[model samples]
Target: MFFRQHRYSNLIIPISYFLDLLIINAFASLLPIQFQTPVLFHAYISFGWIVISLKNEFYKIYRYTKVAYILRLIFTQFVFFFLILYAFIGFFKQPMISRLALAQYFVFVFIAVFTIKFLNYISLMRYREKIKGNIRNVVVIGENKKTNQLISVFKDRTDFGFNFMKQFSAKSLDFQKEECFKYIIENKIDEIYCSISELQNDELTQFINFADNNLKTLKFIPDNKKIFSKKLKFEYYDYIPVLSLRDIPLHNPINAFLKRAFDIIFSLIIILGLLTWLTPIIAILIALESKGPVFFRQNRNGIDNREFYCYKFRSMAPNNDADQAQATKNDMRVTRLGKVLRRTSIDELPQFYNVFFGTMSVVGPRPHMVKHTNEYSDKVDKYMVRHFVKPGITGLAQVRGYRGEIESDTDILNRIKFDIFYIENWSMFLDVKIIFQTILNAFKGEAKAY
Candidate 1:
């Protein structure tokens, strides 16, 4: 569900940064440390502090982040910052910079920073809990055990700042989408939550699209299947897991920028370091064995359901079904070399170009053939949700053994589940893990690789 904007919330990080530097410099001045140029030392410390904080995500605190996590971040940031401080002293050869004074300065800075940070955190919590500031008005669209638990949370946790407005049953004959929209508009609801089990795919899509169009937050109460994945953000209301539909980490601008930067650097490394030499060899082999072009390009559905020409090293003889059919185990269409390339996953390497060009990501939901996208959009519930992020050359599903031929309904379903998980829970760490797993799978061999 949507969060109401706190006027000062946006300023919290910048203000914290400012106060932290202020404390560092102020403590330095008070401590008995001789400096050649006080202004230059201040500048060095300030720049070093900013760099360390950015690297460590020191101020990336969230409402749901625990006090322990915040404390851990503070500890980590200071340890690195402490090193930076000493490096400056050592580099400048400031013999007059007293070691005892530096230690004293650190203790003072730590206490001051710690006190101010917690003071702000505790103050905000108290304000939200006691005064009900920064409140968000939310409504539930279906009745179920999870929804009831969530309603209880809204009622019990005043500090969360959720104002429970009303609950409407999706199963009731009186229920209408238009009526719910009208109520939301009249009541000025900030968030809408639906019970995924109660609503049809069409109804779910309608609510999702409506939320996007109206600029309201939409969340879901997952059914009692215990389908919680590591990637999806589950905000625990007491014991109930409430799933956020659009709370993807990559949706954050800073996160998006970081992922994009990583994609570029990684793709460049692969393209320049490996593909420059490997491509010609593969291309010659494919040409010698096949009548068609060395590279295969087929239309695939990507982010936002847009079609793009996905590239692959041709592993099969030229065929009309290239765009429509998936390669199956021991398929006659596959050339002898194709089997090795497919099994090794070398055939998929060319999509690094797609990652570099921005049509795809290094780790995301694998794009399906355009025809399959249309067929599955109608057959599979929440299938289109995977298109919310760019398609990937290798993905969680691939590493989890759900790649290649969609032999059964369960196959596609499981793949989409993992894909959704990747989209929801994406981190640089997760991406790297998936890539490593992909590499291991390639070397170890996969049953469905063909």
Candidate 2:
């Protein structure tokens, strides 16, 4: 329900933002500059600023997020806008881009969009608190230290919204069914949160049956399971509790949505806008060098143990899946055109489609073959934990020199360590920095690129 409402809320700002951009562009065109260039540039600039705002998490509807937090985010958005504008203008040395107009547009957009978003967030929080609507009522089913801690945290934080109608002790089987029924009847509970270890299969199944009959939500709070230790950070949703088993890096919902939104829009621009103009040319070269399929699709594990077929331009002689080998330096399978593609990282362009499909991120731990996953899971400790988040086109490990074939166990271990570090310390600034470093590294040709 929250997700649906959030989606509906998103529609309002974007619509208002589009009108604001149109006005900004209209204002930009009035100035003395190239008519089309400045107009389009301002439009692009507005779009970029909006994306940065969303990426920086100005859109997350926090129930009790301090007013100071909201202002800090707004200030960060202004900083990003000016920084990006100046950097791009300086890098391109384009004097025609109207600085004053762009600055005005930034101010205009920030005021209009920021006000709408803030109002939406404040209004939603008020609605949830005022009408007592959309706040999930949750019951914790456990009698252990973990449950005690959970209760203590919720009791101290009223903004969490769980109301904490009652916590049922899971110590014994006697009076379990009757007490559970009584709690349901008296409290009018809407959900159940349980510690994973506290309940056996039979008890869990019984509770699940009751929950199903009662039409309540059942989410588990996992203890520091080794798998969760990799990236999970549990958080409460109002009074309702949830276990965050995987960290998608963008903690703020709007930031995460923006990162992904940009990935899709950017990937579409690359594939449809750019690749359409480049594919036939590259295909001819590949066909001339090697008579085989022009693309390669391999099954790779993605976030949450899902498998997706990752695509890349064929740079090798289409090896059989039954007898595949990882590419090494000066491999015989690579064609002359393939070498150029591999060196320039053009072969991975097709994966923009993977990003568009929501199976990959523009930056994250790169996905490996299922066979490689199995082989390395045994060799490297906590290797599978990297699969908690969507694999990326480029990652912190790749930037820090842990790409290419894992020749040593230490290499794989260090790579996993870096991947986890990136996951834990994820922020928009970090992602932007990694992307910049990736571009610079590609230009200098790192040793791991092979």
Which one is best on lDDT?
1
lDDT of 1 by residue, 57-152 (tens): 987775545788889999999999889888888888888888888888888888999999999888877877888777789999898777888898
Residue pairs in collision within model 1: 231-425
TM-score of every candidate: 0.58, 0.55
lDDT for each residue of candidate 2 in 318-341, tens digit (9 for 90 to 100): 667413467888887888888888
Question: What TM-score does prediction 1 earn?
Answer: 0.58
| lDDT by candidate, in order shown | 0.84, 0.70
